[model samples]
Target: MTGHLHPLHEALERLDEAWGDADDAGQLSRRQLIAVTEALGLLHRRSGAMLAEVAACVAHESRTELGAASLAKEQGFRNAAQLIATTTGATAGDASRLVKVGEATAPRRNLLGEATPPKYPAAQQALAAGRLSAPAVAAIIALLDRVRLTLGATETAEAERLLVERAQGLSLDDVRRLVTRAEAWLDPDGVAPREQEQRDRTSLSIFERDGRIHLDGDFDAARGAPIVAAVNGYVSALFAAQKEQIDPEAPDAARRSVAALRAEALSVLCAHALGCEDEAPALAGASVVVRIDVSDLADGTGYATIDGSDLPISVSTARRLAAGGGVIPCVLGTDREILDYGRERRFFTRAQRLALAERDGGCAMCGLPPSMTRAHHIRWWKRDAGPTDLENGVLLCESCHHRIHDNDWEIRIEGTGRQSRVWFIPPPHVDPDRTPRLGGRARYDVVA
Candidate 1:
């Protein structure tokens, strides 16, 4: 209530007031509720900025022996992140982000405890004004830190102002573009060198644990931009399919989460990368090697041992992988004898791929563009003696392709000539009657 009160204390009081104001959220009209929610967000952001400033001060004090270090250490915490996580009920990742944002944007003080300015003045001002989100502020601080190395303090300050102005009118992506553009315009020569430094830091790792493939990687901006574009392209297809399956107007009503879509997008990227002729020579022949016993192949009820992995893959997966995703079928005789190694013979050829593009129009399952789809065999090549020809192949998008492999779905090719169709049958769990649904749209348009 006093003019001399600390900003953090004042912010807390304002936040409490804001909460009290919103006490009748359920009773409010829909129009009033929307307005109140937007207003509350600004209040939340203001309070959050104050909290971040406080966190920074605590972190600074903890660095010195006079702060939380001794107490945190006593509680068996080794690092600031762990300490923050233990004290607050936040996850380690969230705690780390908070600590980073605090360090980058928070105000500072000297030994005598006199008020000192923050390192990122523009960002700090923007945060206090509720014009910049926490993520935007953090992004600016990180970019400015690097830009500061190349430009003088004055130039960096100017860049910050430009970025702040852009942040107010533009999206977070636009802010990123502005930062990237500023870096290029200010220090064109430094771009390549900086990219080289980041590239040297780049690493990709793929490992399987707990029956799932885990991918972790670091990519520089030059390499990363295209990858992001590719993944988003596939993500568009996934969301499109989701819209068809669910409600287009209400994306929140879609069955799959954004994370699930992203994972599928990565899968699409991998498939697209492999399909490219210009890929690395090692991956040029990247056939999923599945070793299936002759008996398993005959009875259609056993695991197919993938090469380089002792753990067996489901029979459905072996069939799908053999038909789709490109596979090297290694059939095994009794007593683990090698019967056959279907090399490029079983894999779909470039000619077949072209034929599929023409026939399927796009994904046979969801009607995504041909580029977003893969030519999967309708009849199992290994089990059903299905040939690697256009007759047996059906183009399915990545998500649908995964569905056929992972779930209890079945796909088959029916009819002849123009009437030829791909029929998708759901698992018995979904429909006991097991009615088949046709993939893609009608070959000829039917006027409503």
Candidate 2:
């Protein structure tokens, strides 16, 4: 049998021979150079087609080898079909697919089974030059799969033409370096592409907002843990002092109200200092306030005069004092008004609040900074059963607070005596079978 050459193939071979002779002689006129350059352009287009043909053949051979391996392993071998999947880092399956393609295209020998396959010269050159890494080669294989999926035979040729044209004058190492730099520049957050794929598969939408920063968008609780602890520590200290003032058998509602007031007062004081420059100076010299009031003994008006000024005390604050932390003033006369005042001490002094913040650190639930959290009442005083005791208060990030109270969730207080306990009940999705979970220390013992 005799092999025949098509007109285009003959023309390309003639041009290749001419270029080969020109290189050997090391001499060429201006006209000869122009002719050679034009021929080289035509040759590049032809080479692109050849490369694509090689790739297709490689793909076919890979499918056959995969089938053979599966059959040898006693696994089911379906019809040979080429598909790329990555396994390692981000493109493990892609490497496997490429390997299979190389195996399938190998020369077949009736006696020897299979012979050595022809090298992918361009790819090999790039790899030898360190222009391409294993990962980059795998990426190319993945890209080829995508091209196969989206392009028909004719379109696939055009796609390969485009890739080959773009890859001109570039070695594999250069391509690899370009791709690696591009990927890092595009995604600096360090989220692995495979993880990103999983996130996409799960349809989890994590995006930034323009106004009123949303906590759920950035789900990192560890970062905010310190701030939560700080707020909780401050609340605990206020409650401990309140417990000393009130009768041991006081009502829960009163105790909660007083605790809430103390906590809020501390919060307000802290906020004032942190928010205002003038107050910052005052805070440095300010002493802690620990005032206690009896809710039942006071007028039903729920108002008390502190420091000669009549202040409207909410039922929340009144209840807190009556339950605990009530400092009784020595009444001069029979009237319910005070005569001789005891030592004037702040419930949450500047030093105490700062120390509490430093100790607790941040929000216990999400770990947001203390500045980002709101001091929350575990039991709402409006319910009349709530106590403002330190045990009933917790430091929750604003988002968690809204998730708890505004979302119809409940927070419980456990433990006993001065050391109270707090637990948060997650919404149904977090844990359907499990009840609410409690966190943080039972006692308010500051480390330093």
Candidate 3:
């Protein structure tokens, strides 16, 4: 058996030598040669295994002093096993295997004996010095082990040399974590890079409809506060006024119904303006007309005539008086005391219209530009409840006013004092969130 194995081992050694020359000359393409070389390498490992078995036999004899002449003392196998295990942190069984292989191959004219093996001494030292962690050291060791199993002896030795050079500054633990994350990327099910990029880049419409208003938009948490404040302001104002009119035992639905509250509030304003309590009086003998002409009615001299007399009041007061009621009653008095003469005429006046323009601005339903909006009464003057007062009137854009009166929607002024407000209730399908969804803030800029 010894004679036959000698020739085969010599042939294998010659083959390994030729493969080395080809690799060094850059004549062997890695892909083309790897398969052939791996097969030969496996055969070489078997030869090493045979030698390891012989060494194991000899070492066992040396350990049994009373048996066959001991070989462990001659080979120093015990010390070699201890040293390999301590330096490599290999299992006792693995350390024994390596020691046996080393002993068997040491006597043979093989490079394994002299190959300055990478025990990862530098990595181990780095871990001890706190520069590298245990995991990183373990990664390096694992890579080295794989190289040894798959490559030629010379190739494995070269890989170890390169690895030790690169592992200089890195900690074992950091290297391990890095490699692990890298491995995750290899998974086919991992999140695509483009999808992640889109997530990082991930705005908030405020419009009106069938008696209902809608607020639908997207905004990040940081920018969302303003919208919430605006919505809450309207809702709170509406609720506060509703609570004042309705009894506490009122059905929650009725009390909270924005439509019901708006109607009641408009009724109150109309009543107050007509000099009547609760409801507006009928205009049985009153004349009704609506017109707009830019003129100074307060100065008592303007382009238009009142009661067939050219009497003008200040522009501000004229506007107020006109909006108050078309016909001004002659009163003999100073600013403090007045002696009323008589009710001369009753008509919608320029002053009242101008007041409506100034107070409501444009569409009460929508904050359209004043030029495009028109005045609308909460209660129709024909119904005998509508008054030409600022509170009884709401400015709405042409489109919105058309939709309100034509579509049967309601509008009103709500709240009192600081919370006094104006709102339009849209029909359903405009806002499913709230019935008669409240109108947004009036667009007119409040002059401070």
Candidate 4:
């Protein structure tokens, strides 16, 4: 609020006075670091709104109707976005977003020069107040614009207000999820058409580049959901297996990054699809999970959600997906007894895996999701002659399992069934006293 300095400049000066120099950020206490980051983030959001307003003005001055008099033409740029991008050092996409947000949020004037509220007044207010980031504002505006024609003016305004409120203090991904759900809720009849559009756009291109096969593809939400689920599951397994290599100096030490693991997972997925199933069953643990309200399923009026996907599908599409062999149709609210086969089978059964998933809540050590974990024997099946029952079996990610086995960590169960707890005992190398670290859901405190 300083008289001479701009608001941003004033804010920056205050920030610098409070936090010292930016270079010393690393030296700050944890609380100071968090506070500074939050402050900086708010400044960023405010600055983005400022930039958007300016960009909107520039775009108006560069309108094609002006022709030779266009500001962008005079500046030797193709258009306002290009000029703004060059001036601000922003990417083309970012510059376009700025223009769109600015135009949507900026005050409008009628033919008689009467000022009116912005198209997305809620988003505009939130951005100006620094309650929403540029990306969040852009997302809300885009969704509102998309559904503007289909929805009434009152409904559109209410949706904008609700989205703006909900989007605050949320990550971009979370905002996207909110937008997706809102879109489905606003236009249930359009869900099927949108799904069809995405399906039509699905494509994959494979080419060899410098001796490596490069795969570039795009899939609709319905088609991509299963692929994503499978790849993540496999990657989790690979990462779990990688943890087994504890010795950094060893010849077999694993150091593959997530991208590399994803490539391997893709190759394995393709191989599995081709009926070259010579690998362990853990690699095929990927299953697409879909959830729909019973009423929605019966009435066919609402949307269904696929796991690992932000997009919503029509109930008809959900039914089709659920019928697939790869899709696991799990019913909730069922009271079933946990099956325990003591040494009857060499490997843990699917029923046992579900029960273990219930108890462990994913890799007991790493807290990966249930889909990414496998039920393994706490007592060695072949070596210790452990049973394949619930007591001896444990759910672990491949990484944790390897880390446990390679590092000589021991797992023990404290109780029985859902009331049970898992503990990992450290070896002499890790803990001279061989302490027991809490494992499973309790370790993550997922229950409480």
Q: Which residue pairs collide, candidate 4?
A: 240-398, 240-399, 241-398, 241-399
**Which candidate, 1 or 4, has the higher TM-score?**
4
lDDT of 1 by residue, 101-220 (tens): 777776678899997887777788888776776666766677777768778989888877777766663446545544554555555445445545776898899999999889898875
Candidate 1 accuracy as lDDT: 0.59
User: Native-vs-model 3 lDDT?
Assistant: 0.42
lDDT, each prediction: 0.59, 0.39, 0.42, 0.77
Better of 3 and 4 by lDDT: 4
Summing lDDT over every window of 10 consecutive residues in candidate 1, give the lowest-scoring window: 439-448
- Residue-level lDDT of model 3, residues 193-275, one tens digit each, is 32234334433254788987665655422223222323332333444334475445534533356556444444544456678
Candidate 4 per-residue C-alpha lDDT over 283-372 given as tens digits, one digit per residue, 9 for 90 to 100: 436667666666777788878766546577888888988888777544332233557788879988877876676567567886676677
TM-score of each: 0.45, 0.24, 0.22, 0.71
Candidate 2: regions farther than 4 A off: 1-87, 90-361, 416-421, 427-430, 441-448
Query: Backbone collision count in every prediction?
Result: 0, 61, 29, 4
List where candidate 4 sits over 4 angstroms from the true fold: 1-10, 21-23, 242-254, 272-279, 330-448
Worst 10 residues of 3 by lDDT: 304-313
Q: List candidate 3 stretches off by more than 4 Å.
A: 1-347, 415-419, 432-448
TM-score for model 4? 0.71
Better of 2 and 3 by lDDT: 3
Of the two candidates 1 and 2, the one with more favorable lDDT, higher being better, is 1
> Cα lDDT for residue 284, model 2?
17
After superposition of all CA atoms, the RMSD between model 3 and the true structure is: 37.4
